[model samples]
Target: MQNPPLNEILIGDCREVMKTLPENYISACITDPPYNYEFIGHKWDNSEIQRRIEKVSGKGNKTLVKNIPYGSGLAGGVRNKKWYQRNRHNILDYEKWCFEWGEQLFRICKPGATVLVFNSTRTVAHVQVSLENAGFYARDMLVYKRSSGIPKGVNIKQQLEKKGYEQPEKWDGWHSCLRNEWEAICVLQKPLSNNYLETLLEYGTGLFYAKEQFGGFQSNILEGIQRDKTEDFNVHCTVKPISLMRKLVEIFVPRLENSILIDPFTGSGTTLLAAKELGINYVGVEIVPDYLEIINKRLDGISGLQGMLPLSE
Candidate 1:
């Protein structure tokens, strides 16, 4: 395979792109694949609607997690049995999609390599199960607790009152779901060929650096108080904070000279940028050409990273 180029974003679908890489080429993976749920803010107007339409569906640049149309029964229009059935079907499809790339990832990473996948708290279990089915072991689930989050669920009492239902007060203060404060990080690992120490000696993997940046041990729950610094150069709607990505990379990625970290769904190139900032090697795959350009721009702007990257720095 001649070894895919390092520290660069490959512009193609990860499922196909990863197949071309040599087996066991990557040491660790830190990625946030599509959540497969189609959505936009409900409080948007015509102008915002048009912008989102152009961003996700225009020009055939639909390689995003929200590839499914907004009004599809699968994506929540009415809460009928048909909608539930459609949603379940899409959920299954999403799990299948996860496995397709996860299998390739399992083949490309060394035994004992870790994969940290950020996804919706509701669906992270599906991601874990799909990767486990693809020959990786589910290790632990990490939580990223945000300082604030929007409550996107529908208010039950308001809807009932609008419908003139009897005793809408019965559903006072009720909503469909909780506030979207925390997200799930599905921690997965390729099975080791030997004991942890032996695998560490042989493959330079099979363990994590447990030391925390703030001091003491690394906890499963990651609390972030820093504001997003990607706002300067990033247009990706779901750009993770550079602080979060760097911490994940520091803990899960090995420091061996030849070791490489990868982000199969390198949205806005945050993972690659984090790895580079830490003197680690990285390779990335982004299916969207528009985002690939954005990634290159972000990477090229790395010289100002200490000021323009994470709010922490």
Candidate 2:
């Protein structure tokens, strides 16, 4: 595996592919990994909670919100002591899984390289902690605000009424959780080589790109990112907005020659396409072959792209 070809999507487990890569070869890592919730039968999301959800949702199609299915850890079940314990154990497993790949990412990233991970708001902290344990320094979290949200939280009032509790009408406005309107983007950087200045000079990393002269000042809060409604939802369950991905690529990946970006879980090749659109080289790994078809179709649809090849700058 002598520097497996760039600007191509590899078909396999990212953890294994990353393990074979040379150390410090990657300039940045941007990925939206499985959120451990058994999201729509993703094989990687094999959590204890998923089994519980299946039992609750049965074999029927669960109610979906936007692209996210509603059959959560509860799928509308009581959060009793046993449930809490099981959920906690699932979270521990999720964190360990994060560390498993985080270590590989840390190994492959150049010193001072950036890593931006998109995760659910509820579990972002666990991912942050896992990355910290994997030797990446925690920086800050970015918020991607959506125009609308999925009200997936269980309705306590409905539950109370079903339980035949007294005066359930009194809790009309009460609910277990708020509407999910945003996602967490964990910002982290590999340990700098000496200092920021030194690292920037040595590896063209350890810094964020502003270029304020060409655009407005950046903010941690990214607002109003919407998906392409025209996208075929059947192709992939969670296809990220191209605008959002391009914004992220522009900021995180430098345009230096041979600079490479890797998205270990390239669900639909959004990051790779975004990198290609910005003239940055990239490599990706996708576990599902069907999704490789989606990635290829999406990449081929690019105005001047062909055969997963990089566009000349």
Candidate 3:
């Protein structure tokens, strides 16, 4: 098959857009999918938690309030009560949902292609099950550790005292949950030929670049600061740092000149930008139009490649 269009962001459902591409065309996939937290509050609504945030952070602190939803007017818990309610389906159902897309990804990827998928710790097991069920072999899990993380949950004793109820003194240290400081990235791969050298020569996959480390040596744990928006690019809420993405891409696509990376859930095109920085080809698909615009604006600032690759008829 002719080379599928590269260095472009297609606006559509990933599953449908992937159908148009040639089979076994993608060399690697690096993506951040939604955690399915079901955040329902609008940006404008000012809840008690927002008011508290404003009070503590002072008024006009746009960074704290922008695009974040505060449910139950309280800070704590991995997700708000509403989020749990919205995603009330059984765990099996959620795994099935993952399978629907994982199956499509498995079909489009080249044999021995590497897949790096970001998932919350809470749901990573389900994602792993789904990917394995879709025929991808589970390789290793990388932990992307961030320096900063929001602490969730409230002090049970303090809440009781505020409500005029007696509580045990030993409960002072108890809380609902611990602060989340890391995200799990599942590394998976398609089946490869028996001979590793032959597989790499035939499919341009089945190998990882260990020498291309971001910090001298590659470890399962990746440490980096979470980067926000800059003057040139609008940042998505859950944007992975460009440095982190670049390192992962380098490891996945060692021969950057010949490989084409694909990001099915390209929120703001960070993976695409990384590919461009490395002078590698890439195709991204974002379901949201607003995010597509943001991606285009981000790509516009990049002078690497011009215009989209024309899709084959």
Which prediction has the highest TM-score against the true structure? 1
**Which ranges of candidate 2 are over 4 A from the true structure?**
39-76, 159-166, 211-215, 303-313
**Could you tell me which residue pairs clash in candidate 3?**
76-153, 77-153
Error of 2 at 246 (Å): 0.2
Tens digit per residue, CA lDDT, model 3, 207-229: 88775334565677887645645
Quote the positional error of residue 154 for candidate 3 in Å. Answer: 3.0
Candidate 1 residue lDDT tens string, 1-120: 664788878888889999888998888999998775732222222344355567666565443333344555454476888878877887788888899999999999998999999988
Worst 10 residues of 1 by lDDT: 304-313
TM-score attained by model 1: 0.85
Question: If scored against the real structure, what TM-score would every candidate get?
Answer: 0.85, 0.84, 0.79
**Once superposed on the true structure, which residue ranges of model 1 sit more than 4 Å away at CA?**
38-69, 165-167, 231-233, 303-313
Winner on lDDT between 1 and 3 is 1
Please give the clash total of every predicted structure, in order: 0, 0, 2
The digit string of per-residue lDDT tens for model 2 on 64-107 reads 32233344453446779976876777788888889988999999
The best candidate by lDDT is 1
Candidate achieving higher TM-score, 2 or 3: 2
Best-first order by lDDT: 1, 2, 3
